[model samples]
Target: MADTGLASERPLRSASFRWFLGGQSISLLGSAMSPVALAFAVLEATGSAAWLAAVTTAALVPMVAALLLGGGVADRHRRDSVLRLTSVGAGLTQAGVACVLLTHQHPAFLLPLCAFSGVFQGLTKPALRGIVANLAAGRGIQRASSLLASVRNTTKIIGPTTAGLLTASVGGGWAIAADAVSFLLAAVCFARMSLPDRPQRTADDPTMLGALREGWGYFSSQPWIWAVTLAFAVNNGFNLGVWQILGPVVANGTIGARGWGLVLSARGAGALLASVVMVKLTVRRPMGPALASMSLAAVPLILLGAGADTLWLAAASFVAGVATEFFTVVWETVNTTHIPERLLSRVGAHDEFWSFVPIPVSQLSTPFLAAAFGTASVAVLGGATAAVAMLLPLLVPALRRIEIHRQGE
Candidate 1:
């Protein structure tokens, strides 16, 4: 393992990081409601799986395009302002979706609005990373990232369930309104933040594309970065594309959409619990032992693979949520701390690309997988892939020895 100069204390001095995290937590809560409201709205209107998939694909398109470019821009600009712009744009887009649903009553209009939200979200990606890297710089990186991950998972606990109830009782229109309002609330929280300054750029700096190439170059040199990315890409397709989509669909039919919400909420609960404990439990800088333990945590797959009775399914989702949260918090924290900020976006993008690259593929392929192998079997295969794929990065010597380290203390 690379020498990380182990220190026992956290990085931040005041409660600012906590406040920052809370603001984001609010934003994520709203974001969590969005997919459910949008999905149900479209499904209610069109009743076509093909159209559902189409809208999903369209929504994500901007994310794939803008993420890399956004990272470069973040390096060049005031990350806080960039974040503010995106948050407002994202919120307005949600409001637009609500207005269209309530007033015009059109699925066609809603799709474009959702896509616009996705585009703004794409712009926020790099700024979010920059803020995280900055706030968590030094000792607190792991805990901060872990808390943030927990916050995101925590949103699933509240957002989806609330959306489901609103849709069930009031109509998708009201759920849309709540989501839009949530964004405004989230914007207020972000507006109050005071992040430290970004690294100043000289007048002769390279273009965004050139900066992108530089970022890519840094990542490519690290076998761990690319290898881990590829591995996650495989797992993500199965994890994000297959499990996320099919899990809810299956749960909705078997347990009820409300039940689906509970299952997802269970995941959030498990993640929330694990992160609370992990915040105090320092990482094993040497990857071998803890990585082995993280690998074993994948045992929940057996539970997830078999079709669930309502109770069993929720339990499995909760279990899987805890295990996945543990893995992600540890991995993300380590990655953020160890990689330099300039190169961080590329590394993040590298891992994220693989993590997300498969989503579209899996989303496209999942129906076929379900038809051929059965939903249970498809889920089983995805779980198995997630369980086994953790070893891919370990195969590279550099990653096995990678430890969380900030450049300057």
Candidate 2:
């Protein structure tokens, strides 16, 4: 089977998987464009960060609320169908936003429309994560994950640049409309892909609340999962959420606007390189390396805190991106291989919730923290805390002793 390239391990050989990759690549590129476009739109509409924050909050709250239920729904139906439906729903909401802005309608509609978009986006998360297992044909899940990561990293570079160009040349409405088009294309691809339906719910099976409880129970039973999830809640909150706010502030002041752009470009390049490297490198023991790779990400935060020259900061950022991507591939591979397919999406949603719940808090709190401790101090503290938090998971024997490949075991 391997020789004929029809083996389950050969994900690239499957036409449906190729289409899946193409659709996801385009979809992620659009998602990447949206932030820059939306930020500009809100600012143009109201000229206030307060209004922008309100719009963002409206989107995030519903997305978080819907995650667990979305996971349940993914397990109850065909994952491909869910992906297609959510893509259509989300595309319509984005189109509505584009239309409202084009006609110069009252900004009030933007809030609800953004919230509606978030609902569909939230519904897609579990299905998105779980679909790779179905696509992998019982093998090559890790390869598929690496391929997806590579596409995403490449798009992160292209999306923002395209968004900036479109928003400046035309308008934010047009840029958002482009995103809507991408979603429609994604829906078309999902519609074409084939996947098996999930098991029908039986009388003995859990209700939604019970399913949530079962997922939580599975998570709690695994010390590694819980430890890592708790650690990442803190790490992501500071490294990602707080940085999303304050990093730009610090970069604009220290490195200047052009320099900050260069730093981001370098980080994206590094992530692309990591994805390419992981194509061949298999992790036998993933846990220790995954934790260590994540800890390395703190160095860039510390570098920024020190107000290093742009060159130094860019180099650190590049390294941090590489480590972060490496950690991501390893983490996803472990989950896909180890978790039961029937419960994978629900458990994944719980994991996603824990990782994201702190993000909003961090975003809201960053300004206050910076005001209280000063920006440099906040960066230093956040970086130190992230390193400590990630490493704490290593204290668990299960985490340190685990091997991912499992062939010998």
lDDT of each: 0.68, 0.79
TM-score (C-alpha, index-matched) for candidate 1: 0.87
Q: Which candidate achieves the best lDDT against the true structure?
A: 2
lDDT of 2: 0.79
Model 1 / residue 174 / CA error / Å: 2.5
Over 225-245, each residue of candidate 1 has an lDDT whose tens digit, in order, gives 787677767767666667656
lDDT of model 1, residue 72: 77
Candidate 1, residue 336: how far the Cα is off, in Å: 2.3
TM-score of each: 0.87, 0.89
Worst 10 residues of 2 by lDDT: 1-10
Best by TM-score: 2
Q: Which stretches of candidate 1 lie over 4 Å from their true place?
A: 1-19, 286-305, 404-409
Tens-place lDDT per residue, model 2, 1-409, is: 1122452477787776777888898788888777767766666677654455567767876887888888888877889899899999998999998898778787788989999998897799988878888877434777888888899889866776676667666767887888899999999998887776577778999888888788888977998788888999989877776666666566534554345556665676788899888877887887898898888888878878777887887798788879889988888888888888878888888888888887777767776788789878988888888888888889999888776673234
Clashes (N, CA, C under 3 Å) per candidate: 2, 0
